[model samples]
Target: MSEQPKTSAAPARLPGGNRRPAGGPPWANAGMPAEKSMTFWPSARRLIHRLRPYRMALLSVVALGVASVGLSVYVPKILGQATDIIFSGVIGRRLPTGSTQEQAVDGLRAAGNDNLADMLARMDVTPGAGVDFTALSTILAWAVVLFVLSSVLMWAQGWILAGVVQRSMYELRAEVEAKLHRLPLPYFDNQPRGELLSRVTNDIDNVAQTLQQTLSQLLTSLLTVIGVIVMMFWISPLLALIALIAVPLSMIVTQQIAKRSQKQFIAQWTHTGTLNAHIEEAFTGHELVKVFGRQKEVEATFAARNAALYDASFGAQFVSGIIMPSMFFIGNLSYVAVAVVGGLRITSGAMSLGDVQAFIQYSRQFTQPLTQVASMANLLQSGVASAERVFELLDAAEQSPEPAAREAAPTRGRVAFEGVDFRYQADTPLIEDLSLVAEPGQTVAIVGPTGAGKTTLVNLIMRFYELDGGRITLDGVDVTELRRDELRSKIGMVLQDAWLFGGTIRENIRYGRPDATEEEIRAAATATYVDRFVHSLPDGYDTVIDSEGGNVSAGEKQLITIARAFLADPALLILDEATSSVDTRTEVLVQQAMAALRTGRTSFVIAHRLSTIRDADLILVMEDGRIVEQGSHSQLLAAGGAYRRLYDAQFTSAAVDLDESGAAAVMAR
Candidate 1:
């Protein structure tokens, strides 16, 4: 197992007063934005660097490609030599013998020179003539040998390339995930989950898809075309000259098509990502759409996104569709030119009939590789676009600078925020001129109406965001000076909405401290009243949970979260609305477990409902990002300040509700 990157904020509040969202997490600052078009503008060397480690495999594939094209040169020669051999024998007035030479030549010589006797004599046993099997046989045997070798090497290349592409994609995604784990809380505040998902899943896939489908093919085609063209010129320079002229003409046409299609493909990919984001957002928030009756609007938005993708895809593919036909026409033109010119030369005795046949074959050969190379160009562009996205993710700024080792651990947990100020953006300060302190082993209960920056204070303690003014210290040391991982290991947290990753109940319970044994897990669970719930289930602690812990109730989720923190046993434990969502009975159970966990540890409890914070060593009442009033519950009530008013409102409402139900009970009696 890998050691997870520690986020700057220790396990503090989960960004909400209660479970899940306080509207959203706290996404205030985002680095580079994804470009609207998938037009990757990075140079070739950087793009191919993704494939760097697999150079040996790529080289092997290239060698095979050259060998495959090398076979092309031999086929024309084989046919040409066979034709030459037959014509030569007919001119010599003899038939070539398969079984030794002299007997057949003698039989041929017994007949007149016009009777094919001299043809046999020339084939073998003649003074200055012999069969020309060497050239024909060499061409045929090499063609077969090259065909088999090319297939084997290409297959091997495919397997090797797949591994390189897949592994790189996996590494890229895993690194991004690790960064997300380390990134500050503010980074997630206002961001959309669907947009992040696009970067990890869709964007990475695009990069890998480009490599797997198009890049290796392009390289292979390029090598093939180069090798075949060289051999074609070598065979007959005059015919090669005619065939080469058609290349530039054909290329000019392809270049125009390629440029247009490249733009189209870039737009198509961007629109595709947009389309995915819209669909993902709408589907994930189906309940919100239904409650708001925004179904029609969402549908309209989806349809428009879908239409844009379709138009872009059609345009790109359609533009590319013209390439093959154009190349085919060009190829045929070269063939016709070769045949007409070579035939006149052969008749004028300046060229052999065999040479004319060979030139025509070579002309077709030249276009086959060139046409494939041109057609693969669009696919090449798509791959480069994907690579750009991958590189962009790899190059994001670090969430926070790594802390140096000279700093010591904050032992006492005596946290103080002195005249502190914080802002996610320059113009908007969330917490302004705030000052507070939690002496070691002290319980600080933070209460507020809403948006009081209650949770923001928790963030400040962990140094998740830098203070704009003043400073916060932990045990006489500036919290920022300590390494983030070592700083967080000392703090434990229990949130209202606990995210249980897919794992067994026992595994979830020990998430905070993975080295915790079964005995420790059971003990922690018992303290949190989680073991009781676990025992009630058939599998007990062995039960598996999904990402949301769907098999368990909301109350059970909170218990498991508490149990997890209990096991970690940190110096500071933050209970950010852990019991805020539970029923009265479950809340009491969770509170008991919290009490056990809080012994010998400093705790920060951010709560609503007001009933639970009465026992806090200090109750800090906050409003509009500042602490308005704070004291013990009785003291605040006696003073009748902000805290007293809030307490009175809850008590009065509870009394009235009891009376209404009490009267109904009396009537039934």
Candidate 2:
């Protein structure tokens, strides 16, 4: 069974005597600020690196893009040739029948129309000939074939790229999951659950979408731009240069707009994570909010976060939205210039009418791709911003590595904390140079006030947190020398909150030991009083527990956890306020079951009720982080120290309550 991460120190008060919430520290709820602009390139580079494994697929996509774009670029030129055929036919038809082209040109020149004469001279036309219907039809059919081929190649490229992106995302998600396990408990303590979840779920999903939508299109657009530029230069260098002018202008516009929008995009996603955190917290504690009549406060907080998200999202989209229109406007300018220049070149006979027509089409192709690329800048920025978040999570500090040579599992549960010094914060000492030894088969009951390091003690025993100094040992073997899994395997823990996953009661009990037989499970249930309550239900042990375990009473949940621990039969057991949730009658039964379970095992019980620990083999009274008194319960009470005060404070109040209730009952009689 996997050991659960321990954040039991959540109940401990900080140095300033302020209580920290179970979820996280206060600063964790504060939204992250917008990232610096410089991170964009680094994050983009890292995202690109994630795709390195798919190089073969990407190369295939590139090849298909090139082939598709080459055909598409050449088709426009072919269509332009068809246009020339129709135009030349119209001019030749207007001339006298059986007249040669030379005669028509000379006639036009003699008529003082040199421009028309020059243009006609450049064309390959027969005098009095009409349109070449058959040739035009053939060129059109070839153009259609090229278009179809180009489309098929583009579709194939998209399919390959989509698969590559999904696979990359799949690997990325797995890495994040592994990273989460490797990260230390303090990392979770300092981070909001919803915020971390957003990076894993929402951000990764957005990255997948961004790559899916943009990768193939970006490749195609870039290839189309290159192909169009080559065709433009071939047809007319002067026109190509004019068209190239718009490239720099588009670049300038895109750069300026992107600079303004990048931070906004980062802010947008950051706020999304923050807002999700708030929503999660609010919903998770919705009962507390209603019971305390704090719904208005929750709503107000949600509205503030929601509004911040809206502002950031609107700013990002509005700024990036300017690129496509600006690109179109610039493209139109280049188009007009190319048109006028191409007309002049045709009139001067420097370029053929067919060539000029092709140049115009090339200009549109070039500008269209540029426009497409510019429009995709928003998605690219947003995706990279999300990538940065995921990378940050992946970069979190992980726990120290386990020793290469591991100690064997401890058979005798002799636990010792030697010269152990620990602090949640570096400067504030909690447990300092504390030494303790629990001999095998001893029930060490620890009694302490709230935030007196009760839960932290058990956590240290489980190796949940590393000590700043000193070592903890089990059966004369250092815990650090043992593999965490091997060490944790011999330990069973039941916390104040009885956690149960969504499953039947039988399955939950079986979770303690997957290999446990049905007889063992039922025996454990019977010992813990779970069998009594479970059998009363229609499904008995088969009754399904919801995610929240709402169907079972709080006391029943605690009993189920006790049964689980009993089934585990670990050599060492830690119960952190395990019986705190049950009522008086059930607590007695649970304590009886615990006594039977603790017979041969070493047990560490953290409790607030002095009555429960009165018969403990050893009772250690802790104040702050030190054990002020240690002895049997009666011995500590006789010493009349901290333990005596604590005992009096509890039993004295109980006696007074009993007397008051008795007098009230007498008056009623």
Candidate 3:
């Protein structure tokens, strides 16, 4: 029977629909609230908790940020004071020559500074000077020093925060990796590899970038806003009230735009994953596409996905782009309003010119934080969206729980399936009330037509899929009672699609038994006839293979995987169409190697070729998930049942092909 791919659970959606929405960009759904409202605080709380290990470093960043903003806010006030001193010197010029000196001396004497008063009495004074240039220079020098100090603090904070962000991301990546291992195989089977890749790579990177680039600024901007607000009130409460009006207007605009843009960003990443999936699928099946003449269709599909991605990306970015410009407009309006009001108060003699100037600076600073907050709104939303995607993967259903203790001893390969009932979906039953057994040191060959549940039997034995009802036992112990690791370690599998990583041939062979010695590795290779080709390569056993095993032929790659299983020396072996891809000569050699490997071990062989399993201790024929026949090859052939029909069909087809070829040759002659 042809093997059917196992059905798995419904795939998880990553925020948006699997593809772009049918209408247009996400904003096309504007005026309607999102299906699920996303607020920043929840994601923020989770992120903070994830970074709790680095809280001390975060606190240091906050402290440095406060110090930096404090210096910045104070500098403007100091500059305003210096301006007032200069203005006073320029405007009040009458008593500067001699009378001013007498007044200064009298004031010093009254304040009990007799020594300073005596010194002032002796120095000659100029009649009139515009300003005290020395004092102004000192104040400017102090301002420059504060600016440098603030800059240094800002740099230090960023340097430390980088470490914090990197370490947090490292932990997050590790957690995702661990989660992948624990997740049930169905999770992988159902989900697209490209989507999963995006979550692990793109989504995590988004979070990292946001934390690194925006985190420090977010803290500093907030402190600047608060400090500036207090300073504005100190300068003039009436003007401070006027500047405060811009805050709500900026927030309202930011919220309305953000609501729409957040949906677009989610759509953007979703389509990005879809686009990636298409690219991956096309490349993986490029040969098939060429043979089937589907290149044009593939290109058209890719163009459609690409266009969807561009639309979503453009919508998100364009909407977010408006925020900064809108903020600037509002900020300018507020700045002008404050300047006009402050100038009026200055002219009325209620506020000094210096005070008016300081208030204007404070007003500018206030608007700056509001603008920054608006800018960060989109970035934070993207980060939070990415975070939610990651967390969803981490929260997927894991594999069945392990037993608290291993109640069964190591398996001796006496496998039994009793009263087995299974199904992929509730309404579709695949295996119904089945039973079977394989004794130790026996080779059981399973043959069936396509969709006959041949591979599903092996899957059940390997515990890849849990049976809905019934128990499978190994060595007279329930397999479920055995620890999963303990159960899997004792069985070795060689699949139809041979996989080799980007490593030396020797390393791939030693994958199962990592500590296998060089001699054993070579022995396994030699036994599997892999060494024949290995010696032809430039580096023999050390020849490096590409990730796709492009450096070796398919037959050679299969031999290497067989060698890997041989090195493992599992107590039970599973070969599902193992020799299906090999040439006739290689198949004979592989059969020889498999015969040796099967000695004294129980094995399950799922194959269509009747010739390969002719010497099996038992042959079982399955159809529609039921065992229709079971016997030795000779006995099954003698019975003239399902096994006989299958054997007859294969050989008959081969004989007809041979006769037709000979007839064609005769006719040509």
Question: Candidate 3, residue 418: CA error in Å?
Answer: 1.3
Top candidate (TM-score): 2
Better of 2 and 3 by lDDT: 2
Q: How many clashes in each structure?
A: 11, 0, 6
Cα lDDT for residue 406, model 1? 67
Q: All predictions: root-mean-square deviation over Cα?
A: 7.8, 4.1, 6.6
Give the number of colliding residue pairs in candidate 2. 0
Give the candidates in order of TM-score, highest first: 2, 3, 1
What TM-score do all the candidates reach, one by one? 0.82, 0.94, 0.90
The candidate, 1 or 2, that scores higher on TM-score is 2
Query: Ten residues in a row with the worst lDDT in model 3?
Result: 25-34
Residue lDDT tens for model 2, 1-669: 112343423343442455555534544434463223346788898999999998999999999999999999999899989999999898888889988889989999999999989898989899888999999999999999999999999999988998999999999999999999888777776667888899999999999999999888898899999999899888888899999999889999999999999999988998999898898888988899999999999999899989999999999999999999999999999999999988899999888888988888889899998999999999999999898888888876788897786646448999999999887765567788889999999999998787677778888878778888899999998888887888889999998888999999999999999999999999999999999999888799999998778999999999999999999999999988899888999899889999998888899998888788877888988877888889998799899999999988887978989999999999999
